[model samples]
Target: MALVRVQNFAVSLDGFGTGEGQSADAHFGHAGDRLHEWMFTTRWWQPGGSGGVDDAFVRQHDVGIGAEIMGAGKFGHPGWHEDPDWRGAWGPNPPFHTPVFVLTHHRREPIEMAGGTTFHFLDASPAEAVDVAREAAGGKDIRVGGGATTIREFLSAGLVDHLHVVVVPILLGRGVRLWDGLEGVERDFQVESTSSPSGVTHVTFTRTTA
Candidate 1:
């Protein structure tokens, strides 16, 4: 069966996904690339990168994923909708080689980019968007690429089947957090974790509920 998943999402010790002050120049905001430094060192990111547990887990991010659902914030910086020429931060060929649904109130026409990625703007709830992405996935898994808010919504609605998070040992005093309003969320999942020598922890939440 096809599943809804969140993969390779990096968060700070304080649970912030991306720090404050997001912009075109700062995709990760003030926290910068610190949150994802662990991922960057993985062989999944580069040929000479680490081939340990981090690389193994990061490599699974693309496995069986045929379509993706991401928040507007993940798609672009604040006020990106205002720019007519803005094609996203990934340039011509986005890393996601599948249909991408971007959640936002201000919906725009679908954009077809290089590779198999196509950006489709949607003004829908997490469940509704999942339904749409599930169809596009053709029985393959649906990936929820997030900037915090989007992942929280799907988790709150009990729509996520699998969640893989990389926890970096840092504190972002202020930023968009992934754990707000999600108290006691571990009750629904089979949680597992492994620490890497690179000072990062890979956490996976497999939904146990039917």
Candidate 2:
């Protein structure tokens, strides 16, 4: 059976996944690369990088993933809908080698990019989109790519089976938060944590039940 997982999701110490004033130029806004610095140090990012605990977790991102679901914010910046030629921030070939469904209310045709990644736009609920992505996954897991809001939705809907979060040591003060309105969310899963040498903490939540 295919599972739904959120992997390598980085957040600040203050719980902000991304900073304020997000634009095409600043995808992560004021938070910048601070949130993802841990992944950059991993060998998975480059051959000469560290191949320690962080690398091990980063490597799991594609272990069983066949399809991805992301929010429009993760697909592009604020005014991306205005540009008809916007392929994505990932140039010609995106990192996602699977079909990607972007959640948005606007209707747009699917974009077939280089590599196996194809961008599919959909206006649907979390459950509905998961249904479509799971079918396309070919029995592999579905990755819930995030920009905070998208992950929160799937988590709130109780559709996520596993979640991996990296808490970077920094405070954004303000931006998009990942844990809002998720009171008592830990009750649904078995949570575990491990601290990295770089001061970042890796947290995993495996669903206790269906």
Candidate 3:
């Protein structure tokens, strides 16, 4: 069974996942980087370390992810139009060692990186992207590595099976709200687990599929 999971996604206390004015330099935004402070220090993220909390959880979900689905802003530049020179923030061998389906209107050829990671641009809708990702993932899980809007899209469509939100202790006066337009959408999620470390709390939500 292939699960559509959103893992290690960070959000502010106010539900803002990213700050406004996103750019190459201001990736998330002015104070948006604070959201991911938890993942940065995690053992799986550490360069040469071998100890940290959620090691088992991170290893099971993060490593060897068969395929990923991301929005254009997450994989490449934000806003309209794609840059040919834009490779990715993750240099050379990215963490993902599988196919990555990027949601974009404009068509671009598939990009193969040093590792097994390859970025395939999709002009299709979210549902179409999911189908492609499922095939790419084979027996493994298909992950939705997102930037708020993308996650909301899948959530609204009732396509996400599990969501892992890492709520960081911070406030970005005004930014991209993760649950901005998610009101009135009826969905049930049970708290699978929770942990507080490094001033951030990790919360996992498993969608109740009736």
**lDDT, each prediction:** 0.93, 0.94, 0.78
Please estimate how well model 1 matches the true structure, expressed as its whole-model Cα lDDT: 0.93
Winner on lDDT between 2 and 3 is 2
Better of 1 and 2 by TM-score: 2
Q: Which ten residues in a row have the lowest lDDT in candidate 3?
A: 49-58
Q: Which candidate gets the maximum TM-score versus the true structure?
A: 2
Tens-place lDDT digits, model 1, residues 84-193: 78888999999999999999998889999999999999999899999999999999999999979999999999999999999999999989999899888889999999
The RMSD (Cα, Å) of candidate 3 is: 2.3
Candidate 3 TM-score versus the reference: 0.89
> Poorest 10 consecutive residues of model 2 by lDDT?
38-47
Q: Summarize candidate 3's per-residue lDDT along 1-210 as a digit string, tens digits.
A: 788898888888888878888888887877656886666665777876435554445565565468999888787547535567777778899878889888888768898998889988898777888888998898788899888889999988878888887787888878777887777544577765565657767777687764
- Return the clash pairs for model 1, or none: none
How many clashes in candidate 3? 0
Off by over 4 Å in 2: none
- TM-scores, all models, native as reference: 0.98, 0.98, 0.89
Write candidate 2's Cα lDDT for 76-121 as tens digits. Answer: 9998999999988999999999999999998699999999999999
